[model samples]
Target: MSPIRTIVLTLLALLAFAANSVLCRLALNAEQVNPADFTSIRLLSAAFILAIIIVIKDKSAIRHINQHGSYAGALFLFVYAAGFSYAYISLSTATGALILFAAVQFTMLFKGWLAGNKMGNQEYIGLLLSLLGFIYFVFPELEKPSIVGCLLMILAGIAWGMYSLNGAKSTKPLYDTASNFIRLTPIAIIGLIATYFYFGLHISYKGLLYTTASGALASGVGYTLWYQVLPKLKPSIAAVSQLSVPIWAALGGVLLVEEPIELHLAISAAIILGGILLVILAKNKH
Candidate 1:
């Protein structure tokens, strides 16, 4: 692919991911679908679609699951997918994405520290700014943030960070991506079953459709695009690109669901995005 095509495709992939958040929020907040059910169906649908694609295009990808490093990937996937979906039942999409991404950033920072990478003053400042922004954004909704919900989002973010870092260490990115989903989908299915009995919620047609699109298009296809472009883009560029996700998701909420875009939300988003950019840019400079 040409340079322009790669960049365009990468942008499209990010858009798809942002749409995933929007779709999930729509299914839950508008359609009254259980978040757990939405998540499970999404994962299962994506797994099925990917299975078909792999079988047709690359049967060898399945063998990679038996390799030495596949388990960690699968574990991360299960934790992230389940927690992320469940959290959205109580949390706003914008708030959830901000918190989750914040956790991911911190995880990366700590990982760097553990690896003996020097942390600069600017990075510390950026972290503080971002954290303050996050607090501000979520403060209005704190009355009933649901302890379980917050914890689940945090855990999901950590799981995703671990998944990204681990995938970086793997020799076969495609195989790792595919195998992780295959392993993770069953766990997601189990959770859906448990949630049904525990919460006494039924799956609706709207939920199934939303989840399936999320799983197949966003999780499977979007991720494949991410893996393809990750090696090509600079880390700083990638980070900046992800900053667009929350903005896109917020806009999506406003447009699709008529969610209010409060002044504080805009302010908080500016702060978080500015801080994240500063940190990423500073790291790249060195």
Candidate 2:
């Protein structure tokens, strides 16, 4: 893909991530669906949509769904999903986001180091600038996270980090992501059973509407786009780039969710975006 196309797709994927948070909040806060059912339907809908997309892309893809993805990727995906759903129940968005973001970057950076990759001084500066900006952006809203909630969010971050690492190695991102989603079938079933026994199934058309959009657009397509970008990016770059997620999320929240925009958000955004640019452009010196 051309550089412009890659940038556009990356931005779109970020937007999808932001939209997901808004959508989930809308549905759950309205009591339209419980967390368990929401997680189940989100994965289920994404899987179905991705499967259709794959079939349309290539009729032969039917037999290829399980060809590209590994069990490890699927397990990581499940862990991320489960941890995210549960963590948000007890943790404030700022607190959860801070922990999750830090953990993801650290996990990916650690993995990159283990893989024999090295970062330049400029890259280190960029990473620190971006992280600091992200922390500042969310600082005012952050609350003390509960022990369990903090731990869950951290696990979610690690799971996502591993999933991204796996995707970075895929030759066929679309196929691999679709397969990962398809592989979630058993995990989704387990979630359904656990939720059924604990809270029962709560269904609503409105809730389904939100979940479906979240799955098909924000998740299925979004993740595929992200996977496509991963191969072109270093793990550190990819992780730092994700600091922009909350900036976009805050923007979307203001425009779509009617949340007020704060001055610090814009200030931090410049720092984060600038830091990302440096990270992307500065050559690795090691």
Candidate 3:
């Protein structure tokens, strides 16, 4: 592929990932659908699109759908999806993305340490800075983020961290991801049923459209594109590239959703993402 095409695809994929937050916030902010219903529909749509992609790639892939993913993987994915939707109930696009990004890196690093991976001084310092930045972001002095939203987004990030780790050794990332989405069917159905019985169902056509785009284009096709480009990029480059996700989400929020960008958010983002960059660089050097 040409360099221009690669860059274009990469940018599109990143935008798609960022759009997930914007879309969720839009749908929930409009009170179009409850988080449970949004999550269920999102997962189902992603599953449908991913399955279609797989079938197109290899006609026989349908028969092997059950041969790839695990129940634990599906559970983690569902937790991430559900928690993410719920968190956005209160969190702004930028704030939720920042918290989720921080939580995911922290969780991944902590897991690595527990697995006997040694952290150098730089890594330790990076972790400390990240923690301090997170504290400052939620410290209640500045705009004051929602405590429940922060915690829920953190949980979602941790679940996503675990899900990524679970798939780290997979030889076929796209196939595994698709299979995992397919496995989410039963769980999504149960959650939707419970949500309907308890909270009652509420979904507008607009809500459905947003959720479908989020699932199919943003997540399903986004992951596919990312995996395609992964081989062409260096590991460090890939790591560094993700730092732009929150920024894009923030832009989308401000321009598309009419959300405000507080001064504190700017400062906190710089600190948190700066620390994450330090860690990424340090890891690559080590």
Candidate 4:
């Protein structure tokens, strides 16, 4: 690919990342669909679309799914999807994205430590800054938008972290994702069924459309594009590039969704994203 094409593709992939938060917030904020049902729809749609793509584009990815994916990965995938959907119920697009992004990095950093990887001074300092930033973002009542929403976003982030960790272990990223989503089907069904019994389904056609777009376009296509972009990017460039996601989401919220922004949110988002960027770059410096 040409340099221009690679850069364009990279930008598009980042936009897609931001789009997921915008789409989710738009749907949930409107109360169009229940989180559980939206999650099921999102997973099923993403699986269907990604499966078809892999079938035509690379069947080898699906050939040895058992070797590439795990139950834990599927569980984490489901948890991320569910928590993400629910968290958006009361959270703004930018705020939720920042919290989710921070939690994911923290989880990965903690997991690495558990796996016997020691952080350098910069990494340690970055981790502390990230934690402090996150706490400030969610505490003191005035800074918090919704305590429940914050916690749910954090859960989503951690789940996403586990999913990322597991996916990194796979030799084939596309195939691993396909297999994980396939495993996620039964789990999604159980949750949907339980949610139905309790809260019942809450989906209008507009809501269904939003959820479908989120799955097929924002997630399924977005992930494929990211995988394509990854090979073209330096690790540090990739890491730094993602810092745009929350910023984009926040801007999209302000303009497209008309969501209000608070000064504290902006400050905290900077601290968290800045800290994570430092940690990532520090690790890659070696």
Top candidate by lDDT: 3
Clashing pairs in 3: none
Model 1 regions lying over 4 Å from their true place = 60-65, 146-148, 170-172, 195-201
lDDT of each: 0.76, 0.75, 0.84, 0.80
On TM-score, the stronger of 2 and 3 is 3
Sort every candidate by lDDT, greatest first.
3, 4, 1, 2
Q: After superposition, how far is residue 65 of candidate 3 from its true place, in Å?
A: 0.5
Over the stretch 1-286, how does candidate 1's per-residue lDDT look in tens digits?
A: 5789879978987888678878888888778887777777777877777778878887876665555337777788778877888888887777677667766766776787799988689988887898888788667667875556777888988987787677555555555566667877667779777987899767677777777888898887787677667667766676677778877888888788677777887898888777877788789999
Model 2: weakest 10-residue lDDT segment is: 90-99
Which residue pairs collide, candidate 2? none
Residue 270's C-alpha lDDT in candidate 4?
Answer: 81
The residue-by-residue lDDT of candidate 4 on 1-286, one tens digit each, is 7889889988987898799998887777664688778888888888888889888986775666667667897888888988899899888899888888778778877887898977899988888888888888778644555888889989999997777656555566566667677788777778778988999886887788888888888887776666666666765576677778889999999987898889999889888888988898897886
Q: For residues 16-81, could you state the per-residue lDDT of candidate 3 as single tens digits?
A: 879999999988886567888899889989999999888888989888888987788888888899
Better of 2 and 4 by TM-score: 4
Better structure of 3 and 4 per TM-score:
3
Q: How many steric overlaps are in each model, in order?
A: 0, 0, 0, 0
As a whole number from 0 to 100, the lDDT of residue 95 in candidate 2 is 42
The residue ranges of model 3 lying beyond 4 angstroms of the native Cα positions read: 1-9, 141-145, 227-235
- Candidate 1, run of 10 with poorest lDDT: 167-176
User: How much is the lDDT of residue 73 in candidate 4?
Assistant: 77
Per-residue lDDT over 55-174 for candidate 2, one digit per residue giving the tens place of the 0 to 100 score: 888889778677888889888988887787677666544345545665676677667668887778887897789778867755664565456776787899899888888888988888
Better of 3 and 4 by lDDT: 3
